[model samples]
Target: MLVAYAWLTLVGFVVQLVPNAGPGALPRTLAWTVLGLGLVQCLLCTGVLHRAIDSYLGTRTVTDARLALPAVLMASMTALTVVLVAIRAVEVGLEVGLGLHGALAPFAVTFGVAVPRRTAALALSGYLAATTAALAAAGLPGADLLAALVVVGLGGLLSVFTGRSSAWYIAVIRELEEARGVQARLAVAEERLRFSRDLHDVMGRNLSAIALKSELAAQLVRRGSETEASVGQMTEVQRIAREAQSEVRAVVRGYRDVDLPTELAGARGILRAAGVDCRTDNGGSQLPAPVQAALGWVVREGATNVLRHADATWCTVWVGTDPAGRSALLVMENDGTRGQAPGGSAGSGLAGLRERLDGVGGTLRVARDGESGTFRLTAEVPLAAGNDATADEAVTDPAGTAGTHGSGTDGKDSAE
Candidate 1:
């Protein structure tokens, strides 16, 4: 709209230069000056307007002076165009009246772009007052001056509406950005709370047990009871402490197996809260507990990737035995893969998952369908002897023993 007004104003200036317009030397010179000012005003107005938008959107700051400059120029140009027309009006007794009103149109359009509601209104009011005074000074008839004021007055109102509307639109965008930031912070806080809860669950009961046994041992020593009871209590305390230490390690490493059904439900809730559509099929409940644990890790990792890496609008999770019923399968699919390589060389999280799956004779596969802009993750663990044999073989096989003992090959292979 601003561009159109600028072009129209330029065209009006060109029209004033024509022979039929009866522009005298002074009028012609003033027209050219106004045209040059309008060009500069347009450029400066564009920059100022952009800053105004950024300020409103909370992305930048702007001072009143920055906004005032373009608005002042717009008013000046409008007043100059009115002065030129008033000069022609005086010469030809209102017959050549308002030939330059088109030039004023661009300034009117730009008034809204360059300033906010109150500022635009004040600027336009000042221009109208100046125009009225110039017309009166040029001996324009009272009726002619009134008509000119009416026309410019309407343009001023239009500019105020335009500026106010732009402000409202920018305000909405600002609010949305703020809301997104708040949501992200809340997600982080929730994650911290979840970690704390897990730590408490892993250590709370064991710590209580250790405390009770310690008290019992103390009581026995004080009463001069059998040393065997005290020895057993101390031994039990040691065992409990070791178990708690292991559980703490598992929690810290995120290796504790989450129940499949519980993780699926949580995933769906989380995705929905983030404004993503989530669907799940919980058909693999009949699978062995170890298989479920491995697949549950897959779901957890997949959901995390979707939240962290993709701009997904929808996610689907499927868990069931493979068609042959020989393997348990977990599949997660989400749209908006962001063109990232699917399952690109394992990050720490996926690497850990890979190790857990490999321990149970499972494989993790990631597929990216660029044409569909979707990412899919598949985790499959054999449901039969393959799962148990993998663990047993690691325990009994001489080659496995050698790999574990020689050059840390088993550790390196698992890391890969």
Candidate 2:
């Protein structure tokens, strides 16, 4: 209210400098002029002040009946002021016609109407053009309309450019968020590969070793070998068997050792014992320990699954280190379930194997040779730095004997 009063006073003072820009003969007198006019304006302001505050707070909703009354009252007061200004302008012969502020009024009113975005833009542009033409007609100074046109054109262009820039920024942020999602998925895949490789490393060789020793013991018994020799072989076979069982359990529980060669050998023996023809073609002599571990998990899971599910006479397990010595591969194929086994439950072993392989930048592919009655599992392992015999030696402390090999860690084994 104080600010408004100051502004009104300033405008009145400016008008007074122009001759005769005030009301009756009383305003013409030096004694009664400024003081009387100021008192009248202050008294008139009291009624408008509370209404202005009420408008700001939106006390009356747009559709409320009370809104019409306040709006009417404000309009009447505004008209009266405008009439007084016009009478003074005429009496004083001052050039007090509409200016920049008047030109902006229509656009402000359109915004109050809450027009749609495109409509608002068109309305603003049209209002500016019309106002410019009116000013031109009113004899605004030489070439000033051209200057006004330039200003209007720049304002419109700025609005458009700023809007487009804001939209582009939002799009870029969305793309970055999507990229982060993809990266997360890739990380999950890599973890699964690592787990698969670890499982192969732990169980494969241990099982294979047990199977071979068991077969050897059986052969010695058939040949009528000495009891001590047969007993020794059986003891070793039982030990390996125990280790293989532990490795299997550990893998299923998502933990396993990092021994590559031992796992491969064990896998071969386990598959062989389960009556599947098993083979390990390479030891990955130059592949990194990480790569070896990944391949080992593949072999372990493959062989374990074969033993548990492949109701077949033969299964074959193969391990190959890359010729360039940069990677390792483990492949297991079984001639099992000529037709679907039971209701065609492939078992959790293959699923678990796939997960483990995906963890270490590795991949596992499973397919059935429809005509050959063969199911195949293949894995690929990429080498990493510091992957040598020394690293292997460093990691091979047999610290994970219980957890990785799956010796059950339970007090007793259930009879098979």
The local distance difference test score of each candidate is: 0.69, 0.52
lDDT of 1 at 286: 82
Q: What lDDT tens digits, residue by residue, belong to model 2 across residues 1-416? A: 23243234324432443354365653344213332443344443333434433333344223334233433332332233234333442222122222222222222221323223465467557745764555455454435555545544454444333333443454565666566567658878997888789877887888788778788888889999677888998888767766676555546544445577788778777566545677666746656666776777676666666655667777666676658866567777778858763346556776776676666666777777767777877787666433543364354323444434444454423321
* Global Cα lDDT for candidate 1: 0.69
Deviation (Å) of 238 in candidate 2: 3.1
Backbone clashes under 3 angstroms, per model: 0, 43
Q: Write model 1 residue lDDT over 1-416, tens digit each, in one string.
A: 44554455456543553333334677666666666766676676556656655665557766767656655765566566556665662243232233334445555554554445676677667767777787678666778767667755764565456655666766875676578678779988998999899999989999999999999999999999889999999989877776675566557646454688998998898788777899999998887777887788888888888777788999999998877789888999999576666555556888888888887778888788877788888899999744575575456343334333433335433443
- Name the best candidate (by lDDT): 1
